[model samples]
Target chain A: MAKPKIATTSLAGCFGCHMSLLDIDERILELVELVEFDKSPVDDIKNFTGRCAIGLVEGGCCNEHNVDVLREFRRHCDILISVGDCATMGGIPALRNTVPLRECLDEAFVNGPSVHNPDGKYPDDPEIPLILDKVYPAHEVVKIDYFLPGCPPTADTLWEALVALLNDKPVELPYQLVKYD
Target chain B: MSQSVMFMIDGVQVEGRAGQSILEAAGEAGVYIPRLCYKEGLSPHGSCRVCTVMVNGRPMSACTSPISLGMIVENDSPRVAQLRRDLIEMLFVAGNHFCMFCEKSGDCELQALAYRFGITAPKYPYMFPKREVDASHPDIFIDRNRCILCGRCVRASKELDGKNVFQFVGRSAEKRIAVNGEALADTDAAVTDAAADACPVGAILKKGVGYVVPVGKREYDDKPIGSDIEAKRPAAGS
Candidate 1:
């Protein structure tokens, strides 16, 4: 009798998929009518203080904070959808899986030029978050109900998946979307 | 009109497994896709787009499409042929594909694919990315010019070997593969030899050549992988 409560959060992505979803423009608003936004960039609600029916996650688990976000998503939502390639296969960022964490940190913090934070002291400065050794897809750590999979999935594919869930049918992507055109 | 059907590729009737792409069916039926990025051991990256084929009527990458049981597929369509020529040429321009004076010259798949597709002249100018070679391993050498960004060696390091050694560091054309930040002088540290052996070009080299055949007896015998490369699927290592 009630519309489903849907929420979305991005952990470690360019947020390209969410913006691409906005590119759908009016349809994303149409999506708004069917699901209540709880904890999204579009909504101000911060903590998982209430129940949710569906949660859409749009990034891979790249660090400890990302891991915490995934666990919070799993706790609140009945079903979880990994909304992009980052959430599904760690996207292009997972390419960093080949190198050592120390090496990357050295480049980012010590050697590379952000200019102001050029010294290694900044990484050790307690304010900055710790970096993980490798980037991983969401499914590697959590139980994902479905995956929308694209660098950013097509709007129709996302729509079809939500509609399928509402209709109580199995929602798996067709080869076109899953295979990434 | 049935959602389920069977398709034929190159006169071979494959059972057409459900949820598989036409490329997979062709592979199962022993029909090769002649692609650079679709390795069985690694994740399918349709980036190279050399596996273009005609399904129904239009050209599409078989690596990404689901097989419709009654689908008609022409693996080596004129369009695919043209694209393969163009894509391989783009890869040549996109990086350094110097075949002559290279060790992997005779064995390189990119070169072999070019030879198979009859690419007599390169239609594009050299992109000349000019990235540095990562000779930072004891038994491996990564000549960036010859690197195609196929990510096979990258994947092989993470998935199979669990070493997590090869990764792309920058964005777009500036994208260069890195092995733990150090250049070749850091070879004394931990490096993966299996990942080195997985490169399809002279991009990664090891010792043990110059004895396969002597001069004069050295025959120019190159073959199309349109029917080969089924030899253990190259283990998904780039």
Candidate 2:
């Protein structure tokens, strides 16, 4: 049987979840044997080549580009998994949910101690992704089939979930394997 | 000393002294009933209902409900566990618990209970309510965003420290922990006080001492909370 195709991405996150995926260490060799990588930073594939069996999204929707990428994954993948606290519950980025967007932007771009905006300008570049009013977990924007909650889910958790999904077995998570941070 | 009272918890016989709660007796028997807001050596407020169990076929807070002679308690059941998970989920959404950036992430009892209940994500909608972070104290910081309102700090201050520096202000959704005075610095509260350490969440944290424990080495890293209680501690003179 052909190996299952897996695509992964990090949107408003620190890319720590991807780091934990790689923390699987030598198990990456076994992972390769079980599933094929597609549209993932691991393979440096910029776009999805075909339909993927699973999509691992690591982060919440913080901007227009994040929503675009997340919706695109939902459209192209058979199963979508929110793979970290950010994707699951907006994590640290969602802290801005409490503050107004205009205030946050002003603080960051205009009145910040290090900012030298003599022109009193804010980012209005056409190329920059428009920031959303509030950071939202992936499930809030797009349907998420599963969620592995952690700042970066331990490597063992990622590996176990992947192994179970690939083999058509139930994901049996141990107490120590699950954490928020 | 009071005579021991015998009880059955989930079909296992456990014994405790008169006036002891079911939760305390269960702990002595090496049983863990998932709970928050019920710290030992403090008054039981029965605030967080994570430790809800079936006492004689009726749901009751194990921490606040006293165990009587021959009382039957059901600690672990699908219904009980689901109740716990639901309570935990409520706490998660009610508070802006951004665990990744929290100073008390790994060491937090609330987070640990969530992990124990296998909660991947709360089923409730995120409130994301605007909260305050009071950094006025020279040695402590109170981030209302992470407070679960368990009243552990309130009890610790009034009962243990004898300072009565903390109290609950407001009501319902507006309820929150508050230092008695204008600022925590002006109050009798100190960083070394038991109240600071009594917080189950990251609401009250000691300043200048964040993340000293590495990400994976903090409390509840390799084991679940209350692991010590269930470790079959040796009896006296063993």
Task: Highest DockQ: give the candidate number.
Answer: 2
- Where model 1 places Cα greater than 4 Å from the true spot, the runs are A1-181, B1-5, B10-13, B184-193, B207-220, B229-238
In model 2, how large is the Cα lDDT of residue B117? 73
User: Estimated TM-score per prediction?
Assistant: 0.49, 0.92
DockQ of 1: 0.01
| Model 2: DockQ vs. true structure | 0.76
Q: Tens digits of per-residue lDDT for model 1 on B1-238?
A: 2244488775555566678888887786667787886667776767678888888777878887889877878875576688788998788657755443456655677866765765533456444444676654555567886788877777777777777677778888888677755774453323444576567656756645523554213222333545453553334334
Q: Write the per-residue lDDT of candidate 1 for residues A56-160, one digit (tens) a residue.
A: 898888888899889999999999988876776566665566567777776766777773563346445466556677886787778888877665777766787
| Poorest 10 consecutive residues by lDDT, candidate 2 chain B | B229-238
Model 1 captures what fraction of native contacts? 0.00
| TM-score of chain A, every prediction, order shown | 0.89, 0.98
Top TM-score: which candidate number? 2
In candidate 2, stretches whose alpha carbon ends up further than 4 angstroms from where it belongs are A114-127, B233-238
* Local distance difference test, candidate 1: 0.69
